[model samples]
Target: MTLTVRALRAGVPEDAEAFARTRRATIPYLVCTAEALAWEAAHAPAGQRLHRLLATGPDGTVAGCADTGLLAGSTAPGHGFLHTAVPPGQAGRGAGAALVAAGEAYLAGLGVRRVHSWVADEDGARRFAERLGYRRSRQARFLGLDLRHAPLPELPATLPAGVTLASVADFADDLRPLYEADVECAADEPGDVDVGATPYEVWLRLNWGRPDWDAGLSGVVLVDGRVAAYSVAQTDGVDRYWSGMTGTRRAFRGRGLATLAKLAALRRARAAGYVHAYTGNDATNAPMLAVNRRLGYRVVASEWRHLKAL
Candidate 1:
């Protein structure tokens, strides 16, 4: 079984399908679609040196896919993120390793200083990264809420005096404020990343325009008509819901707005026929973790962010 990597060009239907397939196979717990795949490949910033590649079987079926690129917003230039994945049944066919090799080489040519990738909380994946010289850095978890079985929390009857809950769609014409709030909230997230300087245009394209993002289902807590906290929801157009992000602006902390927004989002998700809701948080994000625990989310799996100086 000879495995080879090929570039996934924009506007190519097969490439988009392959990306969707590979993502589904490797990470069925999260949301993924062809539209999202195409959007990422087409809209990546020009300076990022982004490229998506697919590994093909001898019969031309997609075996896996990999995305390699420089972290556009990194203060440390030459930092890259390499995410390569093979479908569950296709592992050990050499597709994953080939894709990783291709991705690392691609980043190396672009002068990338380090490469980081996400590894699942499984023995095989952990071993794979360790053998490839990647060292685990931060641990993150994916939580699942059985919306049909898990009891949903009730919304708070009163806000923090002037705070209130609202739908994100109310600000469809002006998402800049939400973006600003997200940046501020994200800076406090525990991670190996410093995402405080996210660009508005980039966020607009990569996040706001994502195919799975449903503004109508997303909830925001507004204080005096300003966004205080929000929970963004993403669905795969089926029974699965993924939490895109949930955060509170710095000043709104301790008001429990974040919990309120998440509860609203989860209720909406259940009404939309989503039986399962998925969310991930850094191991060190105690406040958010506590919020999720209160909403009946249980840890389903964990992933480690692995880094290697290439």
Candidate 2:
């Protein structure tokens, strides 16, 4: 069987669908759709140097996909990412190696000297990464809750004085405050590569414009009429829901506002007929992990960040 790896035809509907399908099949925990994939290819920031690669077999069917791009918001130079995936039954057909080679070549051409990738914490995946000169860096856990069966915490009958909960829709006219809050929270989040201040226009196109982002279901906590904490919600337009981000402002920490916002978001999600919820957190983030556990989330899978220096 002849195999080929090349840049994905972004404008082709079938290629976008195949890319999304491969991602979903390999990493079911993350949210991926044809529209999201196409949007990413079309709207990536200029500095990202994004490259979407696909591996196809003789039959013209996509066997694997890789998303390679420079981390535009990272403070360090030459930092980039390459996420490659091949469906379970399609492994060992040279698809993975082809995708990785293509991804690395593209990033190298863009002058990227360090590349990072997330590998499932499984024996095969770990061995494969190690064989390719990638070393383990950090660990992240994927958590899930059966929204239909798990007992979620009930929202307090009355919020703390000066604290009011509202949907993200409440900030439709202006999202500057929310953007500021997100930047603060993201700067402090634990990760191998620091995501520095994300610009407003970039945030608007990448986060806010996502097809799954549900403004109505997303919860925001206002303290004294100021945005203090928030939980961004995304739905598959079906039963699956995911938490894009849940953070509290620096001054508002330790007050349980993040928990309150997440609880409120989940309640709205459940009421909207979502039956499952998923989220991920760095293994070193103990505080967030505790919050998720308290909310009845269980570890579904773990992934390790692997880095290779070019």
**Structure candidate 2, residue pairs in collision:** none
Q: Write the per-residue lDDT of candidate 2 for residues 1-310, one digit (tens) a residue.
A: 5789988886899998899889989988888888878888888898998889889998888889999999888888999999999999888888988889889988999899999999999999999999999999999999999999998988899878999999999999999999999999998899887777877988988888878799999999999999999999988787888999999999999998899899999999999999989999999999899889989999999999999999
Score candidate 2 by TM-score against the native.
Answer: 0.97
CA deviation > 4 Å runs, candidate 2 = none
TM-scores for the candidates: 0.95, 0.97
lDDT of 1 at 235: 92
What TM-score does structure 1 among the candidates reach?
0.95
Question: Candidate 2, 74: how far from true, in Å?
Answer: 1.2
Q: What is the lDDT of residue 166 in candidate 1?
A: 83
lDDT of 2 at 48: 92
